[model samples]
Target: MVARTTDTPVGRVKPCRLIGLEQHHDERGSLSIVESEWTTGFPIRRIYYLHNTRTGTARGAHAHRALEQLFVAAHGSFTVKVDDGHRQRAYRLDDPGTGLYVGPMVWRDITDFSDDSVCLVLASEHYDETDYYRDYAAFLEDVRRQP
Candidate 1:
């Protein structure tokens, strides 16, 4: 059944998405490709990679006000947890040919990184401190205020 406003937090907001990429191989090697506005559904303005995360560690425990991101596991595997104030979802990223698309106003974090994991993030905007909601309560309040 579909969840309603009284049952779900951020009731009117769009949920995150999992997207597949194209993989081309011809015995030489393999290439995985993703394009902004095509696969990501958002234009990218910034790019970064995360690595060397110690075991049992986590990062990115915050939400953006108006930024979108696509995460690709270019090397190994990791888990991403997303919270929309009223609900939560988890995704395992283990393939370079796949990506998880996270929209704004959603809290997300990365954990369970394999020893060789390399996570690449393509962002829709540049960094801005005002665009971030680092506190869970504040994020919830903000999400509820949206129309």
Candidate 2:
């Protein structure tokens, strides 16, 4: 779980933290599974993956208004830096059995991709352009307006 560093709250959204998925290892190899009940308690509506990212490149410089997402490093590793307009934290994802759960209204910037990195993302909502806050200032404004 992510340790709270600020007394100032960010509405009902929980802070981003590392979630360990169910893993089984055998002579055949290993397998990881993420059940609905074992995740952020939201039904996954979209799933995607990022691969072949150029060197020194980054992605996800935005925040969702209502979308919750889980990110797992299916191969290699990368860094996910999240900001809640109050506190900021960086988590390194290097294990396939572990994931990072990002709640709504939190800004995310994913970077530091390895050569063979593959980032798998499971989202709670389908594609919606309007649901995203691509501007940091706008995201912070909306977060401040929350009651």
Report the C-alpha lDDT of model 2 over 1-147, residue by residue, as the tens digit: 232344444325876767889899999999999986456578988999999998899999999998999999999999988888877777889999999989999999999999999999999999999999999999899887877
- Model 1: residues with Cα > 4 Å off, grouped in runs: 1-12
So what's the TM-score on candidate 2? Answer: 0.90
**Candidate 1 clashing pairs, residues 3+ apart or interchain:** none
What overall lDDT goes with each candidate model?
0.83, 0.86
Which 10-residue window of candidate 1 scores lowest in summed lDDT?
1-10
For candidate 2, give the lDDT of residue 109: 91
lDDT of 1 by residue, 1-147 (tens): 111223233313556777889889898999999887888888888999999989998999999988899989999999988888767777889989889888888998888899999999999999899999999898989887867
TM-score of each candidate? 0.89, 0.90
Leading candidate by lDDT: 2
